[model samples]
Target chain A: MVDDNTLLERRNVVKKIVDHRGNAKIITGLGSPTYDVFDAGDSHSNFYLWGGMGGTAMIGLGLAMSIPDTPIIVITGDGEQLMGLGSLASIGVQKPNNLAIVVLDNGHFGETGMQKSHTSYGINLCKIAEASKFEFFFDVVSNNDLENLIEILPPVKGPIFANIRIKSQNPPRKLPILDGVELKNRFRKNLGVEPL
Target chain B: MKVDDIQNNWEEKLFSLLLDHKIDFLPYVPDAGHAKLIALAEKNKLLKPVVLTSEEEGVAFASGSWLGNKKSVLLMQSSGVGNCINMLSILSKCNFPFVTLITMRGEFGEFNSWQIPMGQATKKTLEAMGIIVHRATHPSDVCPLVDAALYGAFSSDQQIALLLSQRLIGKKKW
Candidate 1:
């Protein structure tokens, strides 16, 4: 269980996770997850979702299934995850070994104004994921747990779900390329696919 | 031949056409109309079939598969099309190649009144989302239309919908 006062910083956690990323493709959910990913330094491998709120995990699943040799991670928020709760079941059924989902849970919907989210009201995402039959489930709260998560992330056979409890502080936004076409082209180009 | 046997044959042909087009990902929400196709995909090793919780996930799944330099197709009923509208915008805006095969309800002696609204609107709604729509009212028309949709989607990076009329799939017994 995470103490309300000792929450992790979203940006720092994002930076640590992304810094260790090697040849791994990333898909970020809307709002803070996108901002945190961009703040970590942009990459052509990163597909940032500007408006598709609940579609992040499915996109990750598709990518993982298509390119089974590559590692794919979906970084999203609790609000976004809740909106597409059914995706967890789908992912569990597929059980893609190359896919990982990291939820930066701040217990609030930061984008729609910091209103209390379902996580704040005792909705345990880890339990839902476990029930959905995720291979690994972790409720990350401390720096040591984050370190363990980073170490195990790359080689971890998933679908793994990790919920990192974050603070309710709004960080300065670092927006990435919002042009959908450009983002798509760059991501494809990185994968050595010719753009249409 | 019995009607069910004839329908199964057509479904097998459709599956083979999809395989011929190199569609590696098959994401769908379960529908009775798509049962034959779904079962074929599940047993085939080459096809990576995923059972989506909702129709919108299939949209995202196809888009992501395309991003990974692979081709994918979505299978859903007409009623589920409404759930995919907003997510479909992502495909059109990005000009990502997308192809969906829809089994239509509420057309040609539809018994359920609930299916009529979405069934009638499926074509217009898809067109409004910038998807080129094609309909097949007979089993003979299914292959060629699906082939055309696959070609247009991959070659021109266009979103295409292939709607299979209820008249072809047969009306629900209930």
Candidate 2:
């Protein structure tokens, strides 16, 4: 197992990926506290991967397919990732080159509580990625490997997976920038809103 | 094929038809009867597949996509048809243009008692919601009918259903 110091690093990996992929968008998940990152970050990314609840990857897959040639990176949690594991197979079969999924597997459902997840089963997530036919996959537990991995991640074919084993850490939480209704309105204005 | 050339058992064909029409946004809850279509749809780059945890979520996602100015479709099983009634009513009351491709179960030689109720009430329920339900029984009926549904969904600004019968799917592996 890697040392503990590197396991909990989040900002450096995010910064490296943001720096490397100039135009790539960071689509955050529901369970993750990413709005703060997006609000504070230097880069301007329009987040649209929210599927009301447990369909993060599905939204990523949809956006990836809808706009070809634009790379999409999903920063999702273990519990959130498990919500749509079927999408791994679905996205894999489609083999969208512009898609990259990074699962922050902290071994718990961190949002609601640090509850034990199926990851407690010691599931080989990289193997799951392989089963989904992702050409390149990495299960990283060290922060030192983060920057180097980001430099080499893109320009790969099909979907790429990174099961970055993170530690459960709850920093001071940020209130949701937009309430569900306001979020809907902001998303409409930002992404072009249409009727049902 | 012309939009009128659509028929049942045309799951894959309908998929290609959807691509041809440039209808990209898709939110689907897996349906046994529409398995082939869903499977084929997963491979299409033009159509984005959004798999929902439940049928209602699919509707909501599709609704969001619609608000985003993207044409969206919801693929669900007959059981999901029941789950979507409230949301579907919202779509109708708002005159929303959304296409629902429903896989019919509980009818024909359906051995699973679980599928019976949904299969029996699917069409009536859809009609009760003011949705125009089209039953596609032949393989050839799927594409054209779907085109019509898509057209109706957009032109009429209404919700439409393409109810795929069990005969279209044949037998279930499980």
Candidate 3:
């Protein structure tokens, strides 16, 4: 059990996730997930969602299937994941080997005034993913677990899922380029793809 | 059913057109009307056929495929169109190319009362999301409308919907 005071910080966890990403295209769910990814560091590869709530992981699936050689990671929050719960089963069926989803389970909707979310009330995301057929799902509780994840993450054949319990606290907003077209163009251009 | 109700080979024609347009990813929720087309798409080695958990997932799936330099067309029934409303924002905001073929219900010979509301509202709902709506009530109308839609989407980044009228598909026996 993760103690309240000792839970891994959201900011640090996001940073570690980004640090080990290794040329993967990252998609963030709305609100804090976007902020967390932006706060980690901006990149041409990061597709930050200012509004699409549950679409992040599905985006990773599509991109992973499109460019099979490139890795795709989606970093989202518990609330957004809950909203798009069906996507887990969808992605599991397709089973893209290069796609991974990392959920920062802060147990509340941090952006919407910290309303208690389903994960706080015992909605187990890892079990859900396992049932959905994710072969490499982990509930990351400690730094050691995160380190173990980091070492295996980039090269691991996924449909991988990781739910990390973090402190439910608001960090300073690190907004990325809010222009959706600009973000889309930059992300595509980064992959040598002309803007569509 | 009309004298010309049984249209021959339209699904095959549409699938060939998709291949001609270089659409490589096909994300769909199962619908009986789309079975033949989905099968043809699955047979293509270059095409990736993704079965979405729900309709909303396909919208973002198409957007992401576009972001990664691939083309995708979403297929769903009118009932699922309601599910895709919010997710279509991903296409509108990013101006991603979208082309969807919707097999309509609650239009001509619908027996299912539960399918009524969203089925009746499908075109308007899509229009509200800034998508251009086209309906093919007959077999001859489908490929031409979809050909234009493919051009409209990929060539100019437009969101286009091709609704296959339930009449053309024949009413469900049940």
Q: Put down candidate 2 lDDT per residue, B1-174, tens digits, no spaces.
A: 111222434566677778877787677877655566667767767776766656765654465344444678888878888877765644653344779888777886777788798789999998998888898776777778999888877665768888877776564544
For A1-196, candidate 1 gives per-residue lDDT tens digits of: 4676798899999999999888789999999999999999899999999876799999998999888888998999999999889999999898888888999999999988999999999999999999988888889999988988887676348888999999988899999987998999999999888886
Residue B33's lDDT in candidate 3? 90
lDDT of 1 by residue, B105-144 (tens): 8889887898889999999999998889999989999999
What is the DockQ of the complex in model 3? 0.78
Q: Rank the candidates by lDDT, best first.
A: 3, 1, 2
Superior by lDDT: candidate 2 or candidate 3: 3
Worst ten in a row by lDDT for model 1 chain B: B1-10
Classify candidate 2 by CAPRI docking class: incorrect
Deviation in angstroms for A37 in model 3? 1.1
Candidate 1 chain A lDDT trough over 10 residues, lowest sum: A151-160
For candidate 3, what is the DockQ-based docking class? medium
Q: List the residue pairs that clash in candidate 3.
A: none
Runs in model 3 lying further than 4 Å from the true structure: B1-7
- Per-model TM-score of chain A alone? 0.97, 0.81, 0.97
Per-residue accuracy of model 3 over A45-113 as CA lDDT, tens digit each: 999998878888888888888898998889999999999999999988988888899999999999889
Each candidate's fnat, in order? 0.76, 0.05, 0.74
Model 2 per-residue lDDT tens digits across residues A130-162? 988987787877756565468665534658888
Q: What are the Cα lDDT values of the candidates?
A: 0.89, 0.66, 0.89
